[model samples]
Target: MALWALVSAVGLAVDDRVLVGAPIWAKPFKFFVSFAAYGLTLAWMLAQTTWGRRTGWWAGNVVVLTSLVEMVIITGQVIRGKRSHFNAETPFDASLYTVMGLTIVVLWAATLVIAALLLRTRLADRATAWAIRGGVLIALVGAGLGFLMAQPTAEQRAAGNLDTADVIGAHSVGVPDGGPAMALTGWSTTGGDLRIPHFVGMHALQLIPLFLIALVLLAPRIARLGDARVRLRLIRVATAGYAGLVALTTWQALRGQPLVHPDAPTLMAAGVLLPAVAAGVWAALRTAPEPESVRTKTEPASDSKEFTA
Candidate 1:
C-alpha cells in the first residue's frame, strides 16, 4: 500500500507535456502500482468488515482510507518530482493517472454511503436534510463513474453481449469526443472523463442509487393520500429509470453502436441512457409525493476535505 501511494504521488506530479507521451525516465510509472494499492486497500476493507458492523458505512471508511492513501501518494510525488504532476494522461496506462481509476470508484461509493447516512438523522432542519441528500447524490454520481471505469475494456466487452459499448474497436480505446454531460450537481472531473467505462460506471452508480433510494428514504414520510401500496409502486416506477440507465450503459459498453459517424457513437450513448433517465425522472417529478414536514436549520457538516480539487 505504501509503495502504491508513493508511485501515484510521484506519477501525477509529472509535467503534462511529459504525460502526453513523454520520454522515458522523466515519465511516471503507469498507475498499475496504484491500482494494485487500491485493490489491496479494498481487500483490507473487506477483511476489517466482520459482518457485525458492516453497514454501507464500511464503504465510507474505505473511501476515506483510499483518499488518505492517495494524499500520501500525491504528497510524496509533489515534494520531489521535476514538475507538478497533473492528471492529464501519462506515457504508461497507469502512469497516465496519479491514482488509479478503481480507487476513485471505491472512494466515490464511500462518499455516497456517508452522505446517505447523514440524511437519516432528524437533523431538526430541512437544509441539513437537503444538504445530506445533495451530498449523497454527488457521491453517488462519483461512484457511478468509478463503476463504469471498473468495467473490462472494449476487448473484454466483446467477449459477451453485456449490452454496453464495446471498447474493442479502434475508437473504443478512449472517451468519446462529445459525450453527454453527467455530474451530480456540478461539472466535476468524475463526471467529465466519459471516455473510460470506469468513469461512466462510477457516475451512473452515484446517480442511479440516489434516485432509486429516494423511494425508500422519502416515500413513507412524505407520501400522502392514495393507498400505501400505490405510492410504493409509484416510487419504484420512478426509481426504475435509474436502474434502466445502468442497464443501458452496461449494454452499449459491451456492444458497439449501430450508427457510424464521428459523433454518432456519442449520440447513440445519450440516446440509450439519457432519454430513459429523463423519462423516468420526469415521471417521478410528475408523480412524486409532496413532503408533509418542514425542515429546520442546522450546521451543514462538510466532509473531511480529504484532497484538493
Candidate 2:
C-alpha cells in the first residue's frame, strides 16, 4: 500500500513543472521502499539480544508518534486539498515550514532508535540477518534523497547570485494554479534522481518486512497453536488481507481508468500503486519458499551451546 501510494504520487507529479526536473521512476521507487526498510529493522531488532523489551517499547512509541505526525500532514492534505511544500514550489507559512523540519527530525529519531534496537535482535540465520542489514544500509540512501526532494529546481542550479530581473520570484505549477511561485523554505533539490531513490527507501519498511512476516507466520507450524486448524485459518486470512490490500489498489486503478476523463490524479492515486504491489505479491507467492529457520519453543533459539563449539 505504501509503495502504491508513492508510485501514484510519482505518476501524478511526473508532468508537473515542479517535479519535471525530478527523475520520476526513481523517486517513487525510493520513497515506496522506506516502509519495508523500517519493517526489516524492527524485525531484526526483535531478534536481537542487545536491546531489552523497554527499548523495543520506546522505539515503537517514537515510531508510532512520528508516523502520526506524517499521517497528520497526509491526512490534512486529503481533507484540506493541500500539497506538501516539499513537493511543490509553494510559499509556506513560516511556522508550518518549521513543522516540516520537526517532522523529519522526529522521524529520524524514530529511525535511530529503531536501529539501536535492531542491532540487539539478531536473526537466526546468517542470510536472513544479512538481508536485514542490507535493508538498514539502503535506508540511509533513502534518507538522503528525502532531503533532496525538498529542494528548488530551476534557479538553484544556476551560478551567480546575480539579482536577476526576476526578483519578483513569481511562477506557479499549472492550470489549477497548483504550486506556489517560490520554493518552500527548508527544501533542497540537489540530487538529480533523488525521488526515485526516496521511493525505494521509504516503502522498504512495509514491503520487505511484511514479506518476511508472511513467511514466518505461515510456515509449517514451528509452534503449538492450541488448535492447529484455527491457527492456519487465521494465517490464511491474514495473508488474504495483505493480498487483498494489493488487489484493492488494483481495483482503485481500474475504477479510475488511468485517471482519464476526470483528470484527478490525486484521486486516482488511491487505486494504482498498491494494487500493482498486490499483484506482485500474489504472483510471487506461488513460488514462495517456506521461511527457512524454525526453533521449537521448547528449545530456546538462543542456547549458549549453539554459540559454543
**Which prediction has the highest TM-score against the true structure?**
2
lDDT of each: 0.42, 0.44
Cα misplacement distance, residue 146 of candidate 1 (Å) = 5.5
Give one digit per residue, the lDDT tens place, for model 2 in 1-309.
365556546654653422323322323333335444554456555555454767767766676566556545543443333443443324343344447557777767666666655655665554244335444544544564466434443453354343332121111111111222213221122212333335446444445445555555655554323233333333343344443433333332223222122235534554564565566545444443445578757756686887687
- Taking the tens digit of each residue's C-alpha lDDT, what string does model 1 give over 198-291? 3333343234334435545664565442333433444444344444544444444435431222246566766766676566545545554555
Return the top candidate by lDDT.
2
Off by over 4 Å in 2: 1-50, 87-92, 154-193, 204-309
Q: Give the range of the ten consecutive residues with the poorest summed lDDT in model 2.
A: 168-177
- Deviation in Å, model 1, residue 229 alpha carbon: 8.1
Q: What is the lDDT of residue 269 in candidate 1?
A: 63
TM-score of each: 0.36, 0.44
